[model samples]
Target chain A: MERRSKITPILLLAPAILIFVFIFVAPFIYLIFQSFWHYETSYVSKQVFTLENYIKLFSDPYYWRIYWRTFRLSVISTLITMILAYPISRMISRMPPGKKGLVTTLIALPMIGGGMIQAMGWMTMMMPYGAINGILLSLGIIKEKMTFLGTETGILIGLVQSFIPLMSLPLIASLGAIDPTLEDASKSLGASPLRTFFEIILPLSIPGAVSGMVLTFMANLTMYVTPSILGQGKIQVFGSFVYQQAISVGNWPFSSAFSLFFLLIMGVTAFLSSWITKSIQKSIYKGNEA
Target chain B: MKKFSMFLLLFVLLCVASTVIASPAEAADCNWDEATCEILDGADFGGRTMVVGVWGGTIEEIYRKYIIPEIEAHNGKVEMLLGGTSDRVAKVYAERENPTMDIAYTNMFESAKGIKEGVFEVPSADAVPAYADLYDVAKIDAYGMSFAALGIAYKPEAFEGEPDWPDLWKPEYKGKIAMSTFPGSDSEGFLTIAGYLAGGDDTTPDLAFPKLAELKPIPLFFANLDELFMMMDKGDVVAAAVFDSYTRTYIEQGANVKFSYPKTPGAIVTMDTLCIVNNAPNRDMAIAWAQMSLSPIVQEAFAREIYFGPTNSKLVLDEEAASKVIYGEEQANSLIRMSTYMTDHRDEIVERFNREIAED
Candidate 1:
């Protein structure tokens, strides 16, 4: 009976498992194989195995510079998103259920739109004489025109705008789970409002904040449209490099290698983030126990 | 006296009637009816769909106005697949065996590469009657559909006079000059011109980047025409490297930009090409499409509407249209064309361009 039950569950998930293998696993395996193969031309790639793609990539400092840029930008976006999303998440979490649902929907509205359109919107707004500058200039905020297109600040603005909701969702979950009376109890012990937050709310919300940060960080790291449009090709990031190699230069082997390497980096980042979140939560509980 | 006046009036009426009674095809010198267009007339397509891939905007508009109607008149449906050159080229190559795209519009760069790889059909007059009438430059790996020269698109207010190649290097214009992104016809042509400025040719690409680096702190690396034009309007970009056809089109549309031919070497030749994918779905329809594309009437529309130089040697534009487009064999031949040398060293050149020009 026990064996039959286990078999039935596997049978129920068989189609989904097959689909995952075909769409994700099978192509991924082929991509790995192709990464090692020698590139003859844009269309024709040789089957023989070679580590030339990896070796060539590692040899160039340009590729590493691009990787560092992507990493650096993503880290900055994540930190900013965390700071901005916390209060909004806390406010939303403490709201009445009816208003909460409505506000949350409105907050997540940008997520429903495609990245291309969003980036294009930002591109228009950040032009040398675009709306942002136009407004500022008319208001006598600046004497000279400020350039936003082809700058890191422009790309950062776009990343943070898109990611705040992602950060807020996770934060709302963890912050909501904290008991209201815990804050009151802390306050009853002669704790200041800020002290109550640090001793009670902030520590409890770390798990959610960490989850949000990781999500935002991963998103910003892999972002293509925002940087490609805002950076205007001046700022070289991993996404731009991959696109230029695969599409423009048509060096698929090298591009495949570049992508796989970044995939490894992404995996390590997620793992570290997860480990840090767990460790912080454990230490907080240990302090409580003591 | 009354009878004489009546006879004169009758004679004048007869002359007017004869002029009005003449065949519509006979009325125009450049007719596309049976007399001049026997190749496309009364063609039976059996209601099948012919898929054509071309860049959207004015180019696709020209095809729709001139070509699509001719096909539809003979029971053929043309589905327009509009996108960038790379995406279309990728499709034609990936589906070479059984291509859904009957006619794919490509640039000179990828068309040559596709033809070399046997992914595209070779150009021949046997399939398209008008092919025989194309200029020498148009007789290549595929049909050279249109030609334009790479030149400077400048704002008049920012320059002292009509600007040339050397004028771009003036100290005042340092950070305001915009360049097209690398690995494209515009950028490659610019590189070749830089090489020329450096006392070498396309054969010596190493000399090009160093000379180009002098124009650093470039404000914009424009791939989109609207973006470049907007910057020019805003007075942020004074001059930009662009093709004549686009500049002319924008000028007509009231954009604050002017097209100038450089004096040092000359404007670089950029050609838009058309190719039939190997084993394309609609072979007969594809042939018909090519014939219509190269016809004099269609070529005239392209010159008038979109400022592309007609590839057909038979196309003689009127004085006004001729002034707007590249007309006459001498002018066509005069446009400087860089060799396959630039395309051959694409990856290296793009890398160098990225390191030097694209980066701050």
Candidate 2:
């Protein structure tokens, strides 16, 4: 019976494990192998191993610019998303249980519509003759219509709007997990509301904030649709560059190499951020104990 | 037991005999010698299915509305795999060993590339009868289904006269023109135009890069046709190097856009070609579909409906339709066929474009 219980759990997990191996692990291994292959021409890749693809990528100033731009935009968008999400998450966290459900649903509504739909919505609003410009014109904010469709600012707006929920949901969970009695005790002890928030609530929510930032940052880093649509092919983010190489240029090996490098960079960044956040959380908890 | 076995054998023999007798009756009763007439009369395809890789949006809608039903009437099924030209070509390459799509529609440059890679089967006159009737410019390795003249699309209010290709580089049009990105047909066409202006032909195409860079304050690079037209209509862009067919569509929809073929070298014509994939499952059906696509009736419909210039020399459009397209032998002769050169240097062109033009 004990053996049966153990075997039963394995049997239940078999399908999931099989799926993961086939879908994720297999493709990842193939991608790595492909990155080493030599590119001859469009639709023609040689199996001969070479580091020429990597060499070319590193030597090119254009690729370095794109990588730097991608990281900068991602970091900026994540920061902006966090700033916008904190107050909303806090409000939802403090709401009564029934109302909190409604508020959370409202906050998650944009996600339910999917990224493409939201992007199109933003495109309509951000176009020169679009609603935003119309309002700006009517209100006499500017003498002429502003061009937002092909600018980095437009892309950043799209990134933050699309990823705000990713930042907020985790924050809401972390903030809600905190005991309300702690705030009450701090207030009774003659602490200002702002001081209580900074000293107690903010420190406690670090875990959630870190996770949220990581999620949003990673998403923004790999963003393709929003930048492609809003930036009007003017913006060459890393994801779009990879797509251009693979599809448009038909350099699969080169694209694979580029993707591998992108993965390495993203992996290193994610690791460092997670490590720093964990260290901060540990130190804060240790200090609280003292 | 012996009696039962005899009866079973008799039943099998009877079924085989019936099938043999019925097969010839189901065969199409049309003369194969007269290909155009045969297509008009329709031919039975023995219930085969042809999967076509083509562009989506209105193009797909037009095919579904006018073309697919005709194939269906001939007892054939058509499954469409719709995407951009590059996407369809990529799929063909990925699935080269066992191709999922039987027929792929791509631009002349990509078609030439596919021909070099051996992804596409070399089209034969016997397979596609309409191949003989197409203009010389349309007869690449693959059969050209339609053509679009690449020219300047400008707002009338912004300019007094039609702007030539070089006029876009003028100070007045700086930051006012929209340009299509590289690895696309429009950009390739513009690059050739730029090359011509810089005193270089297909031989010294690299000279175009420096000239393209000179057209400064760097024009907006539009992602798609919709965005280009929308930007033009919004006055964000005053002029763009665009296809005549797209400009016509926008004009018909009241976009206040005017398309002009530059007088200096005429328009740079881009051909959309159709090719049968190598080792295609439905080879005969794919050939038949290609024949139908290049037929006069379908060509006329495409020209009339979508403003796509017909490649079939036999196609005679109405005055209105002809006005919208680059029709007749003169226009066809004037078309600059840059497929060979573009195919050879596509990688360098795209790389340079990204590094120089796109980055700037």
- Of the candidates shown, which would achieve the greatest DockQ relative to the real structure? 2
Query: What digit string (tens of lDDT, one per residue) describes model 2 on residues A9-81?
Result: 9999999999999999999999998988988777579999899988999998888888999999999999999
| Native interface contacts kept by each candidate, as a fraction | 0.47, 0.58
- Alpha-carbon RMSD of each model: 8.0, 4.8
Regions more than 4 Å wrong, model 1: A1-8, A135-143, A177-190, B1-50, B69-79, B96-100
The C-alpha stretches of model 2 lying farther than 4 A from their native spots are A1-5, A140-145, B1-49, B73-76
Q: How much lDDT does each candidate structure score?
A: 0.85, 0.84
lDDT digits (tens) for residues A110-139 of candidate 1: 888977888899999999888999999999
Compose the digit string of candidate 1's lDDT tens values, residues B231-255: 8887878998899988898899898
Candidate 2 per-residue C-alpha lDDT over B124-230 given as tens digits, one digit per residue, 9 for 90 to 100:
78777889999877886779888888899998888888888878888877778778876788887888888888998655667888887777555478767777777
**Deviation of model 2 at B320, angstroms:** 3.0
